[model samples]
Target: MRFPRTARLAPPAPAAAGDVLAEAERLHVRLGAREVLRGVDVTARAGEVLALVGPNGAGKSTLLAALAADLRAGAGVVRVHGRPAADWTAPELALRRAVLPQSTALSFPFTVEEVVRMGRAPWAGAAGTDDEAAVAGAMAATEVAEFAARPFSALSGGERARVAFARVLAQHAPLLLLDEPTAALDLRHQELVLRVCRERARAGDAVVVVLHDLGLAAAYAHRVAVLSAGRVAADGPPAEVFTGELLSDVYRQPVEVLAHPRTGAVLVAPRRDP
Candidate 1:
């Protein structure tokens, strides 16, 4: 289906709590001895949504991992809640941050609610303080409550995405880190998930999402950080960073930057349909 005719508007920054959710300090990352990121500096503050956009293998996912404190930097720092990530206890960190990787693996057959509730595991501790009300609220907010009891694997791709997002919301963290969150879903589901992310940021959470869809990135993110060849190519407002020259330089393909007629947001399209 064609994209729903949305008036390309950047909603005002949602009402949020105090700012300062996360920071990256000259961060560098490597995986299995392969250098993935180089001298990357980034930050996410409450009340705003940040989207990371890049060509394939541009280290988008690596940067997300570093910001989430999943990957240790070789020479820089990742601070969560204004403190070095390593200093926070695992449970404490989990309580204040949440991450949704590109995919989830569930071997056991459990209802959708079960997988989402697992996000609360970080806070539940041994005695399992996972409040039932919190779980229900998260599910409801993510629009997964309708299928809470359905088997996860049995659900469609979009349904599973909603459930996964519901799980992250259950963590109730002030910071959210997501990787390729809308890669597989249709346009409708993509909008649904992005809306949920926007809702959380409006509620005072700091949000950083990795996205391949530049159009969605433009529409939803307050800022867009473009990465190329393991370094930040450009980082600023979408219209400023998504220039015709920058887009061509980063992707090595001619592209057009169109100003949306309604929201005034910038939309990127390939110069050649191919």
Candidate 2:
């Protein structure tokens, strides 16, 4: 997977804080005869981590795909970097956004370093690019450098997820769309992943992540979009959106939202019945 260094791609310009990098307005998406997303409106902003959270089959992943322009909008519009999603050529879109799918499967036995290096493929042959630095930085950021030479298929599920994330980081695109990045990780790695998301947002990259863990979303996301039945049930700061009433109803289970005893962070848990 070697890319020529002689080809040049213009990097995306730096984004200002609060700038909307991606947005779906009145969006509708259908897969076969079923509508997976219905009239959803959401935005990913520069310098912010936006988490999409909900119960299973709530359309979190589908909405993420729509934002990434992988799925065509059945109605309304999806915009990336201020232009209609369809307007950007694949190469052009690659320059501005990077996506981490729910799973990463490779038929070939590529090493961790090789996989991470693939992220730089979009910037290949682009002037002033340092592929080595980008790859190394991404691996380090995701804590995957320790296994750089291991075969991708040899790693555990959590390890593979980190490596996949490193690849996305290496792309250095201004917008990031991640699907359940913490799903396979341990407690520590889950925190690590969200910390990296916050770091990216701080550096002015827009991050939209689909999360099933409400606690992580409460802690890391600058804004939370709670999805239910293919629609945005609530969208706002976690403090405002993650009420016990809302969550209990959306999940169809007894749930509770509490403030951390020591740090005042939001904590969500199921209400145990006596």
Candidate 3:
């Protein structure tokens, strides 16, 4: 599949210093008998795309949930906009951040446009809320405007994914926590999703995305955080954190990192032994 030149564009500028938007400090979380996060410290600042990448069960999703205030930390603190996440009322938090879960199962029969408009619920009855405009803009950006009248339950997985993303976009929150936003998308759509993330960051929003594709993380993220065994194994620029040795060690597989000859972008691939 061919990608647009935009895919090769330089990473977005780093967020300004002292502009931390969301953070998890010394956070520990457990689900039933399993501890999902351990003393993890992660931060998302305005104007940056921070990708959380790791092998399965590495706590990337768990950490994102904590940062989104969807899951509580057993210990330590989670803050959004410099205040405790727990302190923000649901409506208040919804106005400041948006979350896209790993899987969205909608059994109810709702039109695509209706589903996207649901994102504006937090702004309901609020002064100066442009519900229709936000929903239309989001659908157009996600390429779901064509199917606005279709039932969300009847759409394909990829289509549903785009619609779901439209909802998050409609929310227009400063902080976006997306879990596997491109998981069900095609090659082009995957790039589209990541490009949207870059666009959001460039517009001064903070994005924290859980990505399994190391290459995507390297290409789009201004900063990459590698999580392993419920802890951050590495955190820094993609070129520095995505070294072959570090990736191979953390992923428990022989992975190779190479630079694109022309673009100088980091490329990640797994080594196959014959």
Name the top TM-score candidate.
2
For candidate 3, lDDT tens digit of each residue in 1-274? Answer: 1112221212123446438999999999999999999899999989889999999999999999999999999999999988999998777788888999987888789899989988877666665557789999999999999989999999999999999999999988889999999999999999999999999998889999999999999999999999999999999889999999999999999998999999999999999888
**TM-score list, all predictions:** 0.88, 0.98, 0.93
TM-score of decoy 3: 0.93
Query: Residue 126's C-alpha lDDT in candidate 2?
Result: 83
Candidates arranged by lDDT, highest first: 2, 3, 1
* Colliding residue pairs in candidate 2: 5-125, 7-125, 8-126
Of 1 and 3, the candidate ahead on lDDT is: 3
* Model 3 residue 48 CA deviation in Å: 0.4
Task: Please provide, for model 1 over 84-115, each residue's C-alpha lDDT reduced to its tens digit, 9 standing for 90 to 100.
Answer: 98887666677677999898878989898888
Please identify which of the two predictions, 2 or 3, would achieve the higher TM-score against the true structure. 2
Instruction: Give the Cα lDDT of each candidate.
Output: 0.82, 0.95, 0.90
> Candidate 3 overall Cα lDDT vs. reference?
0.90
- Pick out the ten consecutive residues of candidate 3 with the lowest summed lDDT: 1-10
Task: Rank the candidate models, highest TM-score first.
Answer: 2, 3, 1
List pairs with backbone clashes in candidate 3: none
